[model samples]
Target: MALSSQTTALAQIPRVHIFPTAGEAADAVAEHLLATVKRNPKSVLGLATGQTPRHVYAKLVHAFREGKISFCDVETFNLDEYCGLTASHPDSFAAFMQRELFGLADFDPRKTNLINGDVQDVVAEARRYATRLKESGAVDVQLLGLGTNGHIGFNEPGSASDSHVRVVDLADETLSANQPSLIELTSVPERAITIGIADILHAREIVMLATGSAKAGAVRRSLREAPSTDCPASFLGTHQAVHWYLDNAAAAEIG
Candidate 1:
């Protein structure tokens, strides 16, 4: 298909909307998500953690407080978590999700699913989480945030395109960048458990949020690179329902 045709098809697959700034992008995405929940009260949502998604979570929280949306019947699965941290860890992805999203929404704790990073048999836990996703009929929509290195859900450089539910050592740059908040580079967990590229691809719809000039390079690569494991986010180009919600700064190179 032609490029415009392909973009149109992809938009139909989910919905891609670009905005002037991160806040606008977040607001638009939150509106769409709330509409989906209203239409299908039992929808399963895939959640992602990170600074990029902060505004989206804020908007969702505002809507909830204003009685504009309800998530009581929604089910959620978080994208990744640092492998060795407990849910209580300040820097853990679990805590991030709670502080940023779930705590703000009305979703029941029982309906939310996050990979148990503290599980003794990590491999088995990963498998069980994958199975639960399948049994729950997969995620109706998945929210995503891209790393500056082009990683998505901790699927780092050189990860297999088809890999699923696996443990991976965080890239050096990933650890270094997070050092400040995490106290030290050594304090950052070397490994993490994440949903596989395949699992993320299987979601019914995907909403990828990106912002800031810091993300410009990876955003460009994610849009321009050939679908390859070298840049995990490039695999998203192959996804039928992937929507890139980018701020102007992030989309500068693409434009």
Candidate 2:
């Protein structure tokens, strides 16, 4: 309940904050997330992946090491995972979390949940994942990183609104942006399992982060353009409580 934000007249305009640097924004976000953890010891949290959250998680890891925060009572669900990758794969989202946050902090292993990209029954896994999310109730706060193409999770352009948990084809831009994990562009997985737009909107609160000049155009389009399947991140504006955190470079086009 602490993380639940009241509805506002921001359906077409989302609250935005521009930070001088990515480190400052990440520290701010870490403070907000830690507040939720302290407010409700047993909160359910949703997390995102990619380069944007790297700093945020680093800040969080520092806090945990300093005894400023603890994830021992927090349960987490990741936004998506690349298809055909295993939990042990260096490129997998699970591995990313393990290396960046979980491994460095006091997190509960039993409480951490992620989609298994290596599973053969992708549809069934999606359905099961959706059911689990529904049963857990509204995620206290969902952390997101904007894709260069306006994708939230793997809900690429043209993704259906009614789309719940499902396996989806990756956009060319999304695949390229994930190059850090793959050996080469050709090694990037072409598919992903993701929670849908509907599920994300149902979250109690949504916190999206953007940094670097590469995201300037996408950030502008997502906030200025109409909310449609063409720009999945724009849908966050429709949510009652959402926070948009952008670094100066990422906010360059937001005037």
| TM-score for each candidate, following the candidate numbering | 0.90, 0.92
- What value of lDDT does candidate 1 attain over all alpha carbons? 0.82
lDDT of the candidates, in the order given: 0.82, 0.84
Give candidate 1's TM-score. 0.90
Clashing pairs in 1: none
Which segments of model 2 are wrong by more than 4 Å? 1-14, 183-186
Off by over 4 Å in 1: 1-16, 181-186
* Candidate 2 lDDT score at position 195: 95
**Candidate 1: worst-modelled 10 consecutive residues by lDDT:** 1-10
